[model samples]
Target: MRKPQQLRNRELVLLIFAMALTLGAFVLVQFGAIGELDTKVLGVVGIMCVLAFALHIVLRIRASQADPFLVPVALMLTGIGTAMIYRLDLAYVAHWNVGTSNAGEHQMLYAALSIALCIGLVWSLANYRVLFKYTYIFGFLGIILLALPFIPFLNGGGNAVVWISIFGFNFQPGEIAKICLAIFFAGYLVRTRESLTSTGKRVLGFTFPRAREFGPLLVIWLISMAIIVLQRDLGTGILIFGMFVAMLYVATGKTGWVLIGVFLAGAGAVAATFVMPYVHGRFEQWLHALDDDLYNASANASFQLVNGLFGMAHGGMFGTGLGQGRPDITPVAGSDYIIPSLGEELGLVGVFAILALYLIFASRGAHVGVAGQDDFGKLLSVGLSFTIALQVFIMVGGVTRVIPLTGLTTPFLAAGGSSLLANWLIVAILLRVSDAVRRQPRAVIG
Candidate 1:
């Protein structure tokens, strides 16, 4: 086997570029906000630079052969997000003057903390295969985390039961749960790939897994439905189910499992429309977004969806120029609506660029998964990468009115601590897996 380049030096070079991108973003925010550079923006850049280098240090020590582009891709997106948040913060201050929360400051702090967590994740897992040992444990923990938001005392968010509030702090455990569930899906599927791929039921030229092997799929689907039913979170539920389906297909190379999953998911959705008001309401809004009565109704209206559409339209081709667009007119512009906020400012070009970064990230992750030497590593890589893909699609699709809006944050770009930390870990895990993929050829030859 031919040896691939070590790429550690390449990663360092990219790290420099990534830091430059982030710095540039900070400067833009400063110019857009106060029309002058702030020492605080410089401070944030310094912190990001330190974190970027620290992450590079670990990559050099450990995952030297990992893709050089992953961190840089993530960094550029982070910069854009931070810049937008700062713009919104400035807008809030200028507009209301009453709400003085420095969300951009919080975002930078979260980025630092998230980087530390990502580093710890990278440092702790010298071997990705160790995760395979506790697959069931991860799955159990995932279930518990998902359920936590449903409890009365633990839940806080009014919209969906996805947040947990403790003391003075609030977080969305579903974010963390997605990561754990991906790992569990990967590890478990790796263990069972043999049976899952084997011949059993021959239905119209498709080979289905044996009846006994269907237990895992059944359980996963049930767990997904539970989240939908109990927590009223369609995005997380679909995300978890979609991750499992994608991982399962990767593991077994079987289309049957995917078909089964889709059928069940559709069946569940139909049932949900009948049983759950929330699900029905979303569907109503989605299907009748432009209907006179429905759009203007006092309750279950598509006001948020309509407003987001209008905001994007107002943004136009080149946007009103960053920090100048009225993203604040859209609800929750800092969180779920950040994309629209960005679209309003950055326009189509900026939106496409942001999406391109996501595409590159997902493709690189897919490349890593396919190149792995072991089944578990392959499944894990694919699962983690697919996790981001699913999320970006769901969030972007919802805001654009292409689909029903489910309360899901855009991975790195959206303002949410749980999302920030979780996505960073996803990047960390992929780095480790990529390193393993590169080292495998050498291990075999040696």
Candidate 2:
């Protein structure tokens, strides 16, 4: 194996190229959003450069054996996202005359904070395995984070119960909660995998786990129900339940578990639509988006989705060339609908390129999991990576009308502080695991 210094050197090289790409995006946003580039944005670009290199410096010291590709990929995606937000901010400023509350600026701030938090996690969490030791504690914290959105005073008092407002800043605790849950799931499964895999019955050429093993599955399902019924967020409910099922399958190596999860997920979705008016409405809007009367019923009715579709359609192959496209026409265009905004501006090629980045990032994350010597590391790596992939698929598929839309934001791209922070933390955790895997001694055939 190459020395840790070599890995760090490789990461340094990638960081340089990544920062250049980010600068190019920033430059494009400036030119497209306005007729000329601004020095202020340039300053922000310079800050990001410093921050990116500073992060690399920390990695060199803290996680020298970490995967070289992950951080660079994250930086690139974050840059692309910041550029899009900047473009929208420019349009909003010009149209509404509101020079304050710039989403792009906030995104940059979040990026810096996220990188710092990542550095902190790596610095403090010397051994990823210690997380397994405190699995229950992390699980408890995860549950509290998930429940925070429902606190009467903390609640953002919006349609979403997944957000809490602190000192005028709206935060989605679910983002962090999901990360904590992945760790807890990985650890818990490691402890219980042997019992969970005991053969119970054979049916249709498939073997199922024992009746007692169903406890965890039932608990996850119930949590998903509460998230949908009480929290009023179907997307998060799906994401949480789906993530648990994925980890369970990985732990137990049971095809039966996945099949069961698929069935439960479908049934739960149908049940939620019947029981929850908000969920039902979303499904109806998705199903009948093209119907003119429904589309025009209310100003905010189906307009967002319809507008997003029109934007993408307008974009076609090559988008209207970044800032030239009218992405601001869609509501919440900087967050949940950011991908559509990008699809509109960058065209299909840009969209494909972005997806490819996600693909590579996730692939490397999975590789880290597969290569790890310990079960906890493997489970944690796979769970974290799968969570991201599933979220992206749901977000992109929803925008494209491939699935009913969810309220989840596009990761590293959308204008959400909570997502920014949580994703960066995840990167830190994955890098730590990667380092551990690399440091592990190779098996000897002799």
lDDT of 1 by residue, 315-405 (tens): 8988878767778777678898999999988888889989999999999998887777788888888888998998999999988878888
lDDT of each: 0.84, 0.88
Report lDDT (Cα) of residue 226, candidate 2: 89
Ten residues in a row with the worst lDDT in model 2? 437-446
Error of 1 at 163 (Å): 1.4
Q: Which number leads on TM-score? A: 2
Q: Which pairs clash in the backbone of model 1?
A: none
Candidate 2 residue 383 Cα shift, in angstroms, is 0.4
User: Which regions in candidate 1 have their CA more than 4 angstroms from the true location?
Assistant: 1-6, 442-446
TM-score of each: 0.94, 0.97
